[model samples]
Target: MATTRVVLITGTSSGIGLAAAVAAARAGHHVVATMRDTGRADALRAAAAEAGVAERVEVARLDVTDTASVTECLDAVLARHGRLDAVVNNAGAGYVGTVEQDGLDPVRATMEVNFFGVVDVTRAALPHLRASGGRVITVTSVGGVVGQPFNEAYCAAKFAVEGFMESLAPVAASVGVHVGVVEPGAVASEFIGNQGIDLPALLDAAGPYAPALKAYVDRTLAAFGQAQTPQEAAEPIVEALTAEHPPFRVQTSDRARAFVGTKLADLDGSVVQHLTGSWVA
Candidate 1:
């Protein structure tokens, strides 16, 4: 029988976080499923009830952007569970716009939730995780490796996370703590819709980049049509949490693997630039 570990996951109000929380509970782990607003956790609650894991899943409020909230949530989980086992850093935000259009504030905002959020949560959990020899799994994106057109800010954040995790994994392993990242491709979820991007407005404001932006949108949407579901995307996360020796990185789908592979195979950045440039041109 698998040991019942205590797991904390962020952004459980919807999408991948919610799915991973429910799935982790179903696997006999005590799950602390957190969202920025617990008031919006109806869907997560319903899903837990349906999965018959309601008793094992506890919902908490954790706004990763706030350092205090990150500490508070981690402290609460430790107080309740007596020990921390694993943390899934799944909370993230997306931004879509050319570098010039995004400006500094939006770029910083993207980094706050997607990159710094992970850093804060991981830092808060590290001591406990070290004590338990636990795991740290973060949900990054395929864009982390391959910069997509008009997704500069989002990709930059994810790229930062991937680099951070890759560097931390070895140091973490030395302390008997495991760290890894799950990179998912275009998953069919509210992630895109929740980015708060006003597509029509953005297009109207794009000016010189309008045509390329439209093409990127069309291509991205078409790819999303064949993307994995939230549940499917959560599988790799679960595996990362439970596997005896989880991989340092796991791409959730073959498409994600292929997307990331392109960058990995490129030696002088010429091929990647050619391909990515085509998206905007």
Candidate 2:
């Protein structure tokens, strides 16, 4: 039997976070399944009970963007569990549109959650992680490593996260805290559902680049129309956390792996430029 570990997973209300929580509970870990609203976590709590790990699982409220919530939750967890063995900073969302169409504010919001949110949560949990020699796992995306059409803002946040984790890995390692990232292709999550921003409003407000913005908007919608499911996407994440020594980053889906691989091998940014327009350069 795998040794029991206590894990804290953010964004457990849906998608990969939910799956990771369930998986960890089944693996004999004491799972703290967190969502922004604990009242809405009924399904997750029920699922844990059904999986027979209810006794080992606790549902907590957390909002990664709010530093106070993160600090309070971590404090509560430490008060109860004494130490946290692992932290899965999976609380994030997505937005799809041209940078021009979306403007800086929308991109900033994406960064607030997908990038800074992860940074906030991880920073709050680091002291406990260091104490336990725990691992920090983040569910970034293939987009994090490589740019995609119409996804510049979302991709930018992921890219920032990827870079942040890479830098943090060596720093954390010195203190016995291992940092790893799970880069999945597309998960069947509400991330895309929430990504539906008012493109027309954005375009009308864009003034200068309306035509180009429309083209980018159309492309953004088309690309996400071909995303993978959350369960299938969560496999690589499971592998990363369960391994004796997880790689710094693991590409979950084949499409994600292949897509990212091509970008790395080609070295020609033209393909991405073609998809994302001249802004990619």
Judging by lDDT against the true structure, name the best candidate: 1
Query: What does candidate 2's lDDT look like per residue over 26-88, in tens digits?
Result: 777788999998888877878777888788778999999899999999999988878888999
lDDT of each: 0.91, 0.81
* TM-score per candidate: 0.97, 0.87
lDDT of 1 at 106: 86
Q: Which ten residues in a row have the lowest lDDT in candidate 2?
A: 272-281
Q: Report the error of model 2 at residue 158, Å.
A: 0.8
In model 2, the runs with Cα more than 4 Å from the true position are: 1-3, 196-226, 275-281
Clashing pairs in 1: none
Model 2 pairs whose backbones collide: 188-230
RMSD (CA, Å), candidate 2 to true, equals 3.1
Worst 10 residues of 1 by lDDT: 1-10
